[model samples]
Target: MAGLAVPTWDPQTALLIGAILFEAIVLYVGYGGLERLVGPRLMELLVGGDSGVGQ
Candidate 1:
């Protein structure tokens, strides 16, 4: 197969990959929490309190 060969596990590569994964998870949780905290207020300001606009 012409596919690239996988490299053997190394401490540096493990740390780097772990850091990236940790950052992604942190970002996801942080943004989700912020959205939960402020999303309703933002929607209210943008669309007003009726919430059921179409119905």
Candidate 2:
């Protein structure tokens, strides 16, 4: 005969969950900083078109 098993809360499971949450927060903050640094340059490149030099 065979038996069925169910999942339970344990230290390893908690550690893995915590690690994933930490990674999500880190990525969010990092991408936000990168966007802030590069967003202005990208907007200028898209909208300026390099024609307004002497104006």
Candidate 3:
């Protein structure tokens, strides 16, 4: 039977995980900013006029 073992610290794995987290955060913020920047224009084009909401 195998005994429970303590987790090992792997620098390469840690770096990989950190990079993925960083990329996720950047993508999230970048997409949100893009949406805020272009959402109104996109809606106007699709709706053919002002959305007419939030009056």
Question: Which runs of model 3 end up more than 4 angstroms from their true locations?
Answer: 1-5, 53-55
Please list all clashing residue pairs in model 1, or write none if there are none. Answer: none
Q: Number of the top candidate by lDDT?
A: 1
User: Which candidate would rank higher by TM-score, 1 or 2?
Assistant: 1
Candidate number that wins on lDDT, 2 or 3: 3
Residue lDDT tens for model 2, 2-53: 5676767899989999999999999999999998889777777777856463
TM-score of every model versus the real structure: 0.75, 0.67, 0.79
After TM-score superposition, the amount by which residue 3's alpha carbon in candidate 1 deviates from its true location, in angstroms, is: 11
Q: On residues 26-52, what C-alpha lDDT tens digit does candidate 1 reach at each position?
A: 999999999988988888789987986
The residue-level lDDT of candidate 1 at 4 comes to 89
- For all candidates, the clash counts are 0, 0, 0
Give candidate 3's root-mean-square deviation (CA, Å). 2.3
Candidate 3 residue lDDT tens string, 10-41: 99999999999999999999999999889877
Q: Which ten residues in a row have the lowest lDDT in candidate 1?
A: 46-55
State each model's C-alpha RMSD to the native: 3.6, 5.7, 2.3
Q: Highest TM-score among the candidates is held by which one? A: 3
lDDT of 3: 0.85
How would you order the candidates by TM-score, starting with the best? 3, 1, 2
